[model samples]
Target chain A: MATAAARTFALSAPLPLDNGQSLDGVIVAYETYGELAPGKDNAVLVCHALTGDQYVASTQPLTGKPGWWERMIGPDKPIDTNRFHVICANVIGGCMGSTGPASPAPDGKPYAMRFPVITIRDMVRAEVALLDGLGIERLHAVVGGSMGGMQALSLAANFPARAERVLAIATTARHSAQNIAFHEVGRQAVMADPDWQGGDYYGSGHSPDKGLSVARMAAHITYLSETGLTEKFGRNLQDRDAKSFGFDADFQVESYLRYQGSGFTRRFDANSYLYITRAMDYFDIAEEHGGKLADAFAGTPARFCLVSFDSDWLYPTAESRHVVHALNAAGAPVSFVELSAPFGHDSFLLDVPALDRVVKGFLA
Target chain B: MATAAARTFALSAPLPLDNGQSLDGVIVAYETYGELAPGKDNAVLVCHALTGDQYVASTQPLTGKPGWWERMIGPDKPIDTNRFHVICANVIGGCMGSTGPASPAPDGKPYAMRFPVITIRDMVRAEVALLDGLGIERLHAVVGGSMGGMQALSLAANFPARAERVLAIATTARHSAQNIAFHEVGRQAVMADPDWQGGDYYGSGHSPDKGLSVARMAAHITYLSETGLTEKFGRNLQDRDAKSFGFDADFQVESYLRYQGSGFTRRFDANSYLYITRAMDYFDIAEEHGGKLADAFAGTPARFCLVSFDSDWLYPTAESRHVVHALNAAGAPVSFVELSAPFGHDSFLLDVPALDRVVKGFLA
Candidate 1:
């Protein structure tokens, strides 16, 4: 079951999907750091979030920006690539090299809207196939933050024996109604743009950059805490002493958000955004276990560590506590901590030394 | 100074706006309830928020909807139009019957993109002129919530002798970074729509309803509590038992948000949305008073009552406390309470008995 390292694997076998369809020619793009020790006992799987790619410790090919989790995955970082083998994969519906809507179908055309809708479980299944090919069944740990945390937790629940340690940060066991609502806002923005053209804009003259920019701008606000935005840019005008009294990016926050939106459209695809957000909204772990959260982790032997930020109202500590209570009911050993950080849900990716200590201690 | 009641006042006198521009032929549309009584002592000023109009206790002509604040008005309601002459005006930057972006400019064209940006204080200034024309030397109370609450606080701070009592509910003395961020998202959504046509869509036979709807959907999520949305539409599918596996409004939350967005587009003007949101982003009472919130109300003589909802993270109880501290330091007699309501920031517009009782008692 050993496959080539840092390469794309195409599973030609038909795989069952949650929505009564079977996918063929599934391609999973992945990157591995460090070496798989003898017996593969030192292998640690890292699950990336919605927009993240397999380039966990290197520059992103699309934008040349540093890898999203580079701060936490370097040689001497908490993840400690020097000591353990780390594997990261771009999820199936991602715009990266993964087999997504942008990927070719068996008929040699972009799947686009023809691509099968995927769930968070489906994304995990694709990753698990990658794991299968790596010849690594039982490993050290599964770690992720935000949507990545969802993947890690999913691995622990669905594949109980895959990892001995599970660390999920700034995530929820389920997407809240507000979570779905915000994602829907993004989808609507993308769809409302005529350039989107029902997700068939591939090879078009221009992509739906305006619509994608709006979507990114809306979603970006939810990532950071209100306090963070204020301390960074509060009522400060962009470049004028007096108010312009017209519809220009007057406030510095507006300019910053506009820049973020426009910059995101250059690297991301609009149709991929729609598909991935739908997958997140469809995520409900308890529903997968007959409305019992405890049942989702019942009889699991993996030790769990849950982390939340003090200011992350998006997936608040309350959501983490819900999962912790279920783990407690399931009779599993677990440790939970709510760290103080002003960056809200994005704290896991930021410079939080406390998070580093927590990750190091939990892994140890 | 004596003008007619329950009518529109065309003030040909030049009015200086905050943005170093003078506005001429300012038309303020307002409605009055009950009688002003002799000496005009029983006159009460009730300000409306972002999308509200002068029809606070009457019927809205555009959507055939009831008055926005009918719950707090009426004979035995909190504000009690039975005893006091309650006056509500569509703000200067509003659509409705007010002279706003949709109104004709001096050049005989819809102002559209040419409309000057106005602040919450500018809205208050327009209302103050309406009061001056009505021969009302002083008001019994100035009451508002959300943006309306900003106006109430602004009136108390700027014209200390204009009102005997001030009540601000479900609002902050200044817009938070998150508040401004959310408004910026909406603004970006509108501007991103090519149909917006650089804000000159008045006579184009089509407006940017799609963009405006996306903006409303984003803002509507902020109005309701996450708990409320979870309780109302938690992963419940819309007219289906199984997943659609396509990008339709599968979840009830998506359907609900889409309906909210589309319904809002029918009644609201897109250009006015841009202008009003700009004004709200410009709101900062402390910044107006050299960094001290207390200094904003230092010489105010009006008794104040500040109310906040416990679940409203949008404005939050902490924001109300900051204003209360300022009021206390200003030597203004202030009453403050945090009411428990599941409906987040929109609680002020709903039938929360606690809020009704608080308003009644304070006004009494």
Candidate 2:
């Protein structure tokens, strides 16, 4: 029964946008855990971060690895699939099984750079259409962190009646100056790779893996705190006592980052990284609502819980406080907390029993 | 008169270190301005940052351009070469005619990767030897900014009595976790290039230009701030009205970074980048001095002035405050101020009239 419970579904449908341009032939690669309640009021949607896909509660087809949110989506975990129906889908402009830059263009070749430049709100729109096609109206909660949290907020603002509760963690309502600078560096790294060939490497028997890896490695450092890195790496030599006195990966942290970068290239499309990170950078909830953040949630009834980490310089506690202040000004019921975590901006993905308790309690 | 002013002496010497190892046959590519006052007491040493060389007060030979510190060293500017006998040398482990990975090995081949792993202290030792060879017993001031600032601090701590004053700006006493992580990313970018070939690309006739460019681009981002970046390039299209919907550097910032990266590779050795950044990451003044930051300056009579830029996040005001706190604890005569500058971490290199006034007053 457990084996049969982890089923994925393929849904190809059109998602109409307010801009009058519809995303045609959209394919939603999604997985669901547990069963929808009789009233369909216990449904929960879990959005994924940049580079993440639909395998939030199942194994990934590409890497054959467990879902990225496995720690917080099992039977006894925070989401508690045994008590609630959980749904997660690959976002638009992603490189997984979903529609993305690596997908075929109208000419039948890989889209490469031809894919439309999409925003975080566009991804949420597609997800909402998928939910509509599935004949399931989300009634319980919308929960996500980082870019996923951006989608959660988008959902709450754009479709207030869709969810009863919203949980956003380690997220910013708008990309900060520091965030944009780091993302720009990553984008430059990808573009500098000669193999990239103007992002047309699909049929060239080569990928811009090196540049993408460097970009990933650079971005990865921003996701962690200074203390976390020092505690983990601490100038520790890699596979030797003294320095190699040469240019090998002389430090363990270097080796770890290289592994992360290289492994990432195998599973991700460089163009997708470019598109997704741009979407995140362009995300500005207030800009969408006439430079008034409160207007985005003016009449929203969704109970909100926002969490940030002390060590997260990427989206520091101040960012979360700004969001909370907007929610308060809008007369929306909101609870905010800054938790102590040494993991920096990536604390949402790490082990934090406090976050787990908070999510569980808020959902209940 | 101009020829007489340009006349310089070459000093090649050996530097002995506390570790019993010595850098033999060291070549100090140096340039001096003005005249050393009687007793050589008015001499000032200006160290350069990574990728910087000598010619601090003269036209550079390789680029045929004005010196890097031209703004700070000219008449009526800070450090006032007209008032002090200013000396700037290509640092050890650098490629600007100094002993570095690109230099010839004992066996007549380019050292490539065979060069000894040199630290900041090793660099200071070599500079000390150069000063001795020049018949300078003590310097009125040792001045530098950024990596040059690190060298200035090292000189103050390691060879305290050699200088009466030290000016360290926009620098840190130790590399933070984030600093190390960024350096590691840069190192990986270089090694990932196949042309790097274990740092033996000398005779192979192939330079790891791509890798080195990416590394430089990444480092360049850190040397800037988000505010500075946005003000400079705010999602502006590159030679187009709209996005090409392709990956050809859609933004002006991307194009700028690419230019910086490519230009840097033509002048710098990739191996030197790896070596120097590693040495910087390994630098911890407190760790080197019994885990007591004050002990590094204890009993040292060197006057200190630490300057920081308000918008410089790479080495923020907090980092300068930490150093100032340590200096205070050591009873060192120190002057500290955070200058308001929009140029971010690169403000020291930019035209900041306030910085010039402070430097002139402090050095005087």
* Candidate closest to the true structure, highest lDDT: 1
lDDT by residue (tens digit), candidate 1, A106-220: 8898998899988888888888888888889876999999899999888888989899999999999999999999999999999989898888889987678888888898888
Q: Can you write out model 1's per-residue Cα lDDT over B188-269, one digit (the tens) per residue?
A: 8898888899888988888899999999999999999999899888889999987798888999999999999999998889
Docking category for candidate 1?
Answer: medium
**DockQ of all candidate complexes:** 0.77, 0.43
Top candidate (DockQ): 1
**Tens-digit lDDT string for candidate 2 (A1-364):** 1111333344465566433466677776677887788887888999999978878867777798877878888787889878988888888788777788888877889887767778888888877876787676865999999999999999999989899999999998988655766787788678768788888999899998988999999999888887798898876768896555455677788888889999999999999999898888778898788989999999998899999999997888888999999999999999999999888889998898899999999988
Please give each candidate's TM-score. 0.97, 0.89
Model 1 spans > 4 angstroms off: A1-6, B1-6
**Error of model 1, residue A1, in angstroms:** 29
Worst 10 residues of 1 chain B by lDDT: B1-10
